[model samples]
Target: MDEYRAVALGTSFMMLSTTSFIGMGDIVTKKSLDWVLSNPKIGNSLSILGRLMDDMKSHKFKQKRGHIASAVECYMKEYSATEEETIIELRKQVNKAWKDINEEWINLTTIPMPLRLRTESCTYQ
Candidate 1:
């Protein structure tokens, strides 16, 4: 899958919750707010992880329902990969996204721990 499509689809799912956090008034300072706005990598990672995981779990059901194609379908079509191979590659992507999330959690020290925890925890939901 193209990077933009993957990132866009994933990030769209996260926008509401991320906005809610911003709306909560926790990120009050200009610097903290700027940090949140500028450093979107963690949010992107969460979105990618969530999206791929959901696709892995639900793509078959969705396909049967005639729903729109998921990342699995897209990946398979784009690369001529079998379903099993697509899943394996997607799993690798999911793993990488998790690493990105954890790395951001540890490295993005400018943002407070509570906010970072909220960002990380929301991925599981």
Candidate 2:
């Protein structure tokens, strides 16, 4: 897979997961949904973290089963990087994503603490 496609898949996955969690928490009103939609950085950050972590852990297994390229593979191919180098760079990105998540969470004063917790809790697991 290419860079764009890998990123888009991750973003879509994150949005779907985040939205479902919020909906389950009964916080899916128009205003709340709008806020979630408008402020996507946190979700995107979470997506990047989740995608890279999963790919890093499962890439070998997936490859053994003939799965398509993951973000790790895409990065390696695009940059002509070794696995170790790719992993190191991806780890840096994951750390940045965590930082972004914390920053966004701190700035989210409009949402109730409980609702905010509900949205972020899923990402922890």
Q: What tens digits encode model 1's per-residue C-alpha lDDT throughout 1-125? A: 78645554645535544564665574546666566566478877888887889999999999999988888998989999999999999999999998998887778887677766766776676
Query: Which model scores highest in lDDT?
Result: 1
Name model 2 segments beyond 4 Å from true.
1-28
Clashes of each: 0, 0
Residues forming the 10-long window of minimal summed lDDT in candidate 1: 8-17
lDDT of 2 by residue, 1-125 (tens): 45544554445634664555543555556666666667467777877777778988988898899987787788889999999999998899889989998998889787667667766766656
Cα RMSDs, all models? 2.4, 2.7
Question: Alpha-carbon error at 67 in model 2, in Å?
Answer: 0.9
lDDT of each: 0.76, 0.73
Q: Can you give the TM-score per candidate against the true fold?
A: 0.83, 0.81
